[model samples]
Target: MIAIGIGLHNFAEGLAIGNSAAKGEISLAVLLVIGFGLHNATEGFGIVAPLAAENVRPSWSSLVLLGLIGGGPTFVGTLVGQHLVNDALSIAFLGLAAGSILYVIIELLAVARRAAMKVVTTWMLLLGLLLGFATNAVVTAAGV
Candidate 1:
């Protein structure tokens, strides 16, 4: 479920990338790829963090399955967005992604609360937000 939510977010990102490319903004497309690639690296860990917390050693196949579930949509969405450049559709996808990702965050927060690690979770959440802001600053500074 978490993977699905993240996948939806990545799909929206992919649409942005593809739309830039389709519009002949190759540089913007590349920039988006670089920025989103960095973001996706962390997202992969996020998709697996719950299993790590549970001390569950997922099988290699399961890891691959999760990767596909979480990352494959980017590729699929890129294909679709490249062929179909519709602002309304892109906006709809972004909205869905935001809602789904929010759901995932809420669910994870509940798990953290259940684990009685509110302090650690709160600090980690703050750190993540700071890092995300830093990343955005860098990407924005790069003129993306």
Candidate 2:
């Protein structure tokens, strides 16, 4: 359920990127996609981390569903973004995304703490943020 929610949220972000690009906001679109793709790579790891820690392999159906939840949004968002690009709407969407992602991070941290893995959780969170920023920087540098 959480995975599906996260995936749908991600898809909405993708929509923003696609919408911007469709409107000829190429630079913004490219930057958004690059940043989103970078963040998503970490998200993939997040999805499997708990299972991996438990030494349990996710079933094929589960993996497929996870992938759909995680990736289906990119296509949908692209289509939506192509059709809409209002600055206020984009800002609102971003705020919503940030809030949801932050909640997920907090939940992950709580889980890690309960498992007595505080250090690893802290580092991973930091690394995720750094990677996100780094990717955004590169995209910005490229004038995208």
Candidate 3:
């Protein structure tokens, strides 16, 4: 469920980029997509990390659902963004994404805390965040 939420948040962000690009906001769209794609690649690991830690493999159905949750938003967001590039709309969508992501992070942290695997959990979380920021920084530095 948490993975689904995170995935949905990611998908929406992708949609925003695609929609922006469709509307001729080429540079911003390209930059956003590049940054987002990098971030998303790492997010895949984040989704699997908890399962990996528990030594449990996720079922195929769950994986599919998670993919849809994470990637489906891009399609919808693109359609909407292309049709309507209102600042208010964009801000609202972004806010929703932000909120969802925060919620997932908190939930994951709570789980980690309950498990009492502080060191590994903290390291994984930091590693995920660092990887995300590093990838984005590279994209930005490349002027993409």
Candidate 4:
């Protein structure tokens, strides 16, 4: 389920990359790819962390399938988004992605609360917001 949510989010990100490429903003597209690559690296760990916590050793094939489920939509979205190139369409996809990720975050927060990590959750939330802002700042500074 977490992979599905992340996949949806990645799809939106793919759309952004594709739209940029479609508009001939190759630099922006490249930057997006680099940024997303870095972002997704961390996400892979997030995807597996719960399983690791529970001592669930997923098979290699299962891990591969999960990877595909989480990342494959980006390719599809890129293909679709390349041809669309409309602001409204991009916004709609992003909105959907946001909703999906919010659901995941809410679920995770519930689990954290159950584990008595309220303070930690608050700090992590703050750190996440800061990281987001920092990433945005870097992207913006790149003149995109």
Return the top candidate by TM-score. Answer: 2
List residue ranges in candidate 2 displaced over 4 A: 50-56
Tell me each candidate's TM-score: 0.77, 0.82, 0.72, 0.79
Candidates' lDDT values, in order? Answer: 0.78, 0.73, 0.72, 0.78
- Ordered from best to worst lDDT, the candidate numbers read 4, 1, 2, 3
1-144: candidate 2 lDDT, tens digit per residue: 457656766867776777677668788778777777777776766677667767899999998888788778778877876777787777766776677677666656665776898788778779877987887788778776
lDDT of 3 by residue, 26-140 (tens): 7678767766666666566657667876789989998777767666776677666777666776667667668877877787787678678899987887987897678667767
Residues 1-50, model 4: lDDT tens digits: 87888888888878877887887978778777776776677777667766
Error of 3 at 88 (Å): 1.9
User: Considering TM-score, where higher is better, how would the candidates rank from best to worst?
Assistant: 2, 4, 1, 3
Question: Model 4 misses residue 103 by how many Å?
Answer: 1.9
Please give, for residues 1-144, the per-residue lDDT of candidate 1 as tens digits.
789888887887777777768868776677768767876887777787788788899889999999998899899878877887777765675566567667778878877876789999889889877876787677778775
Among residues 3 or more apart in sequence or in different chains, the pairs in candidate 1 whose N, CA or C atoms overlap within 3 Å are none
Compared with the true structure, model 3 gives a TM-score of 0.72
Name the TM-score of candidate 2.
0.82
